[model samples]
Target: MSLDSSQLSTAHSGKTDLVCYPTSHHILFWVNTVSYILPPIMTTNGNDRTTQWKTTIIVSTSLQNHDTSRMLLAQHHRIRFSDAVKSGSIVFPQSGIAFLIINPQELPENLEEAGLFDKIKKFVTVHRNSFLLLQAPFYGKKELDIMSVIQHRFLGSNLRVLPVRNNTEIVKGMLTIAKATSKPHVDSMRDRMSLARAHIIESSSVWEMLRDIKLG
Candidate 1:
């Protein structure tokens, strides 16, 4: 499917955060220009366990043939295509997060027109933890404008914006965020983070200096 750029506004914004929650309140780390937060590789039964798990994603039937869906399938994810979902959207029920993928070129010139905000409002209502995937070939003036509008409109809400350049980025970002924010995986990541923090404190000169001051 192709989008018309004329109706799109310009946009841009990305920041790194390191919150360690396993839900909507989680960290967003940047790597290879894609937003991802993979934990350190762990071993189980002498097998290296990365974040690749058999996760299920409920996708809109409208995107059943979309490239993003195909990419996710290629990665061995279980995808259930549903007509009941909002068009161009996918849901990771395990994480309680839903992603609406929209090409920047598809957005209306103004956020208020064509009930865009209302549609997004309903989306966020249904999926308490929602993310808007702004897909574009690259971040240009028009893309940045739309992103800015989306951010402003959803400010202070659970709706997060993930700007993706291609189907690969879209699938990668969604899976990264979804996996990081879901169940046992999240717990494991937290444990690893705690261990790392303790290691840092133990190895740091600042802590040693403080200890010396206390002893003196």
Candidate 2:
């Protein structure tokens, strides 16, 4: 799905802290480039200590490629990487707001697929605090259909799925997530509620559009 104006506009505001990208070598290049453009830190309690705030970018993939994935990301000093094995083992920070990128190719054929679903469920459970970002597959429509199903499941878990069409959209989505998660404690609840409502509306619209296209 293409990113709407609101999504694109957010990138310029420098709001997101943690962002995850696909494990592909091509995506790794862009993810590394984007990480250099760090978002501005919002002052907390009127303090000017900028060193306390940090943005972490992570690369995620399956365990079969864990060694290669780490090697690919090793050159990028600012980016961290992790892989989720079928055994439900995943390595990621325990706490903090994160923008998780889910490449359609890296996911199971469908969310209902047994063993893979369990692994995914465990991964999501561990990073329940994250904002999931679903990127369209580099392939075509069939892959997108599968991605849509995965997107819906994440939404059901109360996690917002930010859709992106391209690399630019990915950056924008990350910033948008950062902005939402970085709100003050007093405003955080309201922000989350608003975001949840938006996701519900957006997801419903996307599915409806998909059904219409399929029928047509």
Candidate 3:
């Protein structure tokens, strides 16, 4: 059974086929990303360089050729899809790779012709150390179905995939966390400053401004 992008998720359901990538990192962090700009990385595989969650891959195929977006990921070298597969097999990296955004529902015909099933089997040969960031639709139970496919394909006994879908639920979740962590009383200037600082930290950095500041 093949998994689609939406099938990608971190939810657990009675020993799910797809395992969410594990870690103790930020939603987005510095990675050895290729392509280097907006939505730079296409995929990532990891073993132990992560403790919680690491955003290592991005499905910016549209931005694959977009160098500005590619460079932002920190690493300079750009690994391609073809390089990912060697001798008709996928190999995991020693250190965990990050941020792999995949729309697995659709795969390259060349890859399929080369035997996708066989290749994935070899790739997941028990703790192969690869991580995938698959895409998904909306959010919820739909993730379970998406993850099921990825789980069955890989052969690694120790490989685990973490799933996250971009949706309204995520937004609501962040807001919920903020309220839970914050006190209702905003009675002082320091508290106000703290709130402002929290907002600044929580918000996504404006990349354009960051890119400019990085130049000097």
Candidate 4:
């Protein structure tokens, strides 16, 4: 599902942020690069324990992509998405994540596909409580339209149709997705709400966000 690259446009600026890359908000966008994008999105777990976990997960369209994300996140510490979840190193989110950082674009022909897009859509719809952040390339118009359809059809809350138009938006989008992943990582009951709040984003943390996530 390689995008046509001519469909995305910046014409609509009524109230909502249509042109996200150039003039969306405070954050910057970067492409094909990762540094410190933003702190992982986290939730205060309802079932707080003695350890106080910080589950940093990297999600994408396919499990393979998720694997890709896992390798990328390993540079930070002794953390991997699969281990974080399997070993309970990274607990699941309080409200399950319907989906996050999904791209329909094909990775390779010989990957032994498992009906990727269909499966992703199914998971997102079934798990209604989980947050779904749909990542889409902002090349031009065609990709944007496809993204719009996916967002509208999905039965999830606030299906965020992210615009990875330029490096700034891509970086900012990664920051947002990583932060969302943190809810499962630092799964603590107390201060979960407070932690989720983006009040104190540090400089170093911001750079981490850049490196952890990717853009198409």
Instruction: Name the candidate that leads on TM-score.
Output: 1
Give the runs in model 3 whose Cα sits over 4 Å from its true position.
Answer: 1-101, 105-116, 140-143, 152-156, 166-216
For model 4, the stretches where C-alpha displacement exceeds 4 angstroms are 1-54, 58-78, 81-98, 104-117, 129-137, 155-158, 165-216
TM-score, every prediction: 0.71, 0.41, 0.32, 0.37
lDDT of 4 by residue, 12-75 (tens): 1121121112222222322213211322223355441212233444333234344334433543
Report the C-alpha lDDT of model 2 over 64-155, residue by residue, as the tens digit. Answer: 35432343244332455455322313222322444545566566554566454454566667665655555563647766686566666655
lDDT of each: 0.70, 0.44, 0.34, 0.35
Q: Per-residue alpha-carbon lDDT of model 3 for 6-102, expressed as tens digits?
A: 2322211222221212222122211112111111111246342222222223223444454323442333223343334433222213123222334
For model 4 the local lDDT of residue 139 reads 48
lDDT of each residue in 1-216, candidate 1, tens digit only: 111222111111232234322222235444224344444335576443424566889999999889888888887888999999888899999988899988878776776876777878889989998888888888999999888987898898888887777886676667666766788877766555444444444565766888889899
Give the range where candidate 4 is weakest over 10 consecutive residues by summed lDDT: 11-20
Q: What is the lDDT for 32 in model 4?
A: 18
When 2 and 4 are scored with TM-score, the better candidate is: 2
For each predicted model, how many residue pairs clash, with residues at least 3 apart or on different chains?
Answer: 9, 1, 42, 44
**Residue 23 shift from truth in candidate 2, angstroms:** 21
Ranking by TM-score: 1, 2, 4, 3
